[model samples]
Target chain A: MVRPVNPPASWWRSGLAVLVVLGMLPVIGNIFRNDSSVSRCEWDGQVMRPEAAVTLELAGRSVTCCDVRCARNWLASHSERPTLIQVRDEHGGDPIDSADAFFVRSAVVTNRANGNRWHVFGDRETALRHARESRGRLMRGDEHPFAGVRGLE
Target chain B: MIVNAYAILSLFVCGLQCAVAVWLTGRWLNSRRAWSSGWTDDGAEVVERNAYLMMTLALVLLGLDLASWPLLYLLLQSYVPSWPGVMCIDGVTRIGTGSLGASRFLPGLLVTLQVFKPLVMLIGGAWLVIYLANRATSKAPLMRRLLWGLLLIGVTSLCDGVCTAGYLLIPKQEDHLAAGCCTQVTSTTTTRSSEPLLAGVSGTELTVVFMLLWAGLLFLLLDSIRKQRSGRKWMGGLLAITLVVAVLGGLFLVDVLSPALLQRPHHCPYDLVSELPESVIGIVLFMAGSFWVAAGAIASFCADVPETREILPGLQARVLFLGLFSYLGSFSLLSVQWCVL
Candidate 1:
């Protein structure tokens, strides 16, 4: 077993250890909560974690998502504390809390740029209100739906 | 192909080697003190034994690593026989791409490992000199011993720092700001207004400055040898001769080989044989410098004649000083200049 060479908790070593712990905060938060709704509203490489596969427990059912963005979308309707989540969000230093969010629902012209088909709602209303505002429109019947598992209890 | 892995491993081992050398030096001093007194213990003896074992291990590791190039060639012949697989001595790619600092593209992850190889060599060289200097004290004068010890520390550090910086600054392969070693002449639209003196200078000037410093050190080494006892002068003289030969070899390549042999007919538009080849002059200078360094290194390690004690230390110190000057100076000279019309 290796012991510390100069072992009275060397100030330099302690400082370095603290710095490393602080650096790990974002990464740990990401694994606990999928901040997808906020991410979709601000989609400029700041949105979802790139190509991350996550399993989130919403309400009583288990939902598997391609990424944090998908997880956030499913979590809006299904009321539950997210278990095993991944947070991908708000890169422009914008604080994207669930409260005080704007919702805009229009047939967003799908193009190569802004590639992900996301239900963006982080403007003027909470996510739930935004979902209700869009009720029974292009987002109605599941025809060619977003490529992911949906509606976890 | 897998040179990156080899380089990283070598660097890690080099750190271990440096630590071992320091430990051994401490142990040797302790043992000498014990032996001087009447009381003696097996502990000192054990330390001495361990030191020698460590030294031997370090040498064997270096030798094995150096042998890898040949070993790869042999393996290739037995396995997938291809034209490219067979390594050519002349066209062998210089280690590490220099794109880390020189270009828009992100440097390859593996290229970073290239910086460590030269560092390992510098440490290894210094370690060898120190080990030899310790053993040669009986035959060397005080000055000679001191010089060797000083040189070992100074030269190694200089080489390590300079080579690291050069590889980072000057891309090994052809870059957009293409300078060192790659100059293709295309057009000859000579601008008459450019500073004539600065115009002649190129990236190769670093090599020239290095060569000049080395030559000066070589001369000092020769004078030190001349002062040594009658029989020991021959060793110093021989070393001086070897130094001269090596310098000449480098000069011949830079001056005669590159211009007379390597230069092809006009291909690129920017090409112009504007002043006498500055690179050739630089090569000759560096060659002279390398010769002196090698000579000093050998003499410090080998000579132990009765009257040469003082001379050994001085020679060692000169070697160390010159080694550093050449290594860093060469890189600096190359970094600041480039191919132009």
Candidate 2:
């Protein structure tokens, strides 16, 4: 049987050099993928999560969380509280005042934009039913303890 | 019909494919004419020269064929991040159609180009297979059968490519076309339950299934090597199985790999390459590795058969090794990114 010919030493050297170049690529990519000036999640400064998008009116400007769960993290970084916060309902996809929405805190269903597994439903029955089926914790949006607790009050 | 560098290169490849078909046919006719006239001096050397020329031309076509997929992907992706869901060539045509406002010429032409691209890619693979077979052994009968097969594929591929030239020549301008993202392609955002692979299985289970499938393909290939005398039929069976595995791997890549790279649930293959250099590297390797698996299987399908039986085992083993290593290396990279990296 004719054995397969082995590639030479220079092949290894060139291969190693190519890997080195490839290794540096992630560092360059990190720089490009991350930008300080773009409006991003206050929690991570990354782009807003599309499905988990929660917009808050706060301090004469808009504050957004890539994930609704990031709302707390954003609040912790700021002293002033938001006057209004709106979260989209998972079932209906209509934006509802966060104070009025029911939230199911679970890992069963995930928001696509942000990696948060929690989903918000517009009503208590639906939220509780989801929790029953998916083994999630049913709670009011304010129960998650964002500054919007005052809004619910 | 946006005539960019990729479009021009595709046209050139189409021309090259046609030229090769003509050349091969011409060579066959000349050989037959010479054979009927009885023995001729310098025939062997002339045949040798022709083989070298064909080898060079086949390699060039194969390179173009392999590159065309990624090239088409890259050209269209450059429009994305601004315009999403334009992953397929036809989706790009949709964008053009939207921009031109009720014009059939652009979309009609681009869609035709899309149809031809895959046909040509299939023929290109056949060309590579035939070239490899010719060099593998001096079995004229099998080569004759394979060449006939190539002729059918080549005629269709060439005709399809030629049909798109009129559409490609039109100048297309990019405009305010709000091409949909994956969300639009999919009716709802939470349609995961509808996916065939994920229908009854959890994501973790799907991952395990894919790993086992890949391992099984490797095991089968190794076993085929061990039983070389009886392996030819088994290799054909294995090829059918590997093709299934490759298709499943592609689905998994679309469903899981893209999302893993993005660190999010909703994912696009085009976006994976555009967003991360690592993703592009990993996916390119994965695809190339899988192709090699299919190609190597095809090349060795009839290796254990009589006539060329003595000459094919070594070639099969070598090609299989290339396929195996490529797949292993690519998946290893993917695994790292998924879990650790």
- Per-residue CA lDDT of model 2 for B26-135, tens digit only, reads 65455445544654676644544554554454455455545555655565544332233232222444555434443336666556656666555544554565455555
lDDT (10s digit) by residue, model 2, range A1-153:
854433334544664555455445555556666644444554433465455678878768877776676676566546667788888888757888877888787757363333466778888889899988887897644466453545435
Q: lDDT winner among the candidates? A: 2
> Ten-residue segment with the worst summed lDDT in candidate 1 chain B?
B265-274
How well is each residue in B1-341 modelled by candidate 1, as lDDT tens digits? Answer: 22344344444444443454454445445544654564356754654454455456456544533343223222222221122211111112222223223432223322333344434444455455545555655532333343334334333433433433332344333333344568543211111111222334442663465456545554654444334222345445545654565544444344433333223211111111121123332342343345435545555445545554644555465454444344334323322222211
lDDT of 1 at B38: 42
lDDT of each: 0.38, 0.57
lDDT by residue (tens digit), candidate 1, A1-153: 652222123533553553355334334444444444533221111223333333454467554544434344545434455533432222222323222223233343222222233343334334345445545222322321222233311
Q: Which ten residues in a row have the lowest lDDT in candidate 2 chain B?
A: B185-194
